[model samples]
Target: MSNLKQELKENIIELLNLEEFSVEDINDNDALFGDGLGLDSIDALELMVMLDKDYGIKLTDPKEGKEIFQSIAVLAEYIEKNRTK
Candidate 1:
């Protein structure tokens, strides 16, 4: 699901207003928080919204969100398996 991963990268940059980053700047295995991409709790919330709105996947647990948001690769796999849209 390379296309899905790419779309996710694009959407994240746009959604978070991360103007300093580009799609090519984010690797599939890079962490989305703390150090790799340097995202914070606010960005995570936005991503959760994007997941629900774009993939029809609603997350209810913060712990689960932590696991899914580990990296673009992991997120893409989770979406491929669980996405309803």
Candidate 2:
């Protein structure tokens, strides 16, 4: 799980093109949107693609992404459980 979390941070930085953020800049529990990382809906769509392309996890419902993407920890957990790649 910890390893997954670290991978998630790295993936997020790369996938989101967050040049200003390093893996250390993201906390396990930090919110990824709004007042946290300040990501918008477009970022969310990018993340959905990241999940599918990298993890082989497909989220058909955007609403499901809300809970899974609340933080790196949660996202990592979800991926660890569901990732096919």
- TM-score winner: 1
lDDT of 2: 0.91
Q: Name the lDDT value of residue 53 in candidate 1.
A: 98
The lDDT values for all models are: 0.97, 0.91
- Backbone clash total for model 1 is 0
- Please give, for residues 1-85, the per-residue lDDT of candidate 1 as tens digits: 9999999999999999999999999999999998899999988899999999999999999999999999999999999999999
Worst 10 residues of 2 by lDDT: 7-16
lDDT for 27 in candidate 1 is 97
Off by over 4 Å in 1: none
* lDDT value, residue 75 of candidate 2: 92
| TM-score, prediction 1 | 0.98
Superposition-based RMSD of candidate 1 using all C-alpha atoms, in angstroms: 0.5
Return the lDDT, model 1, position 8: 95
Q: Candidate 1: lDDT of 23?
A: 99
Give each prediction's root-mean-square deviation over alpha carbons.
Answer: 0.5, 0.9
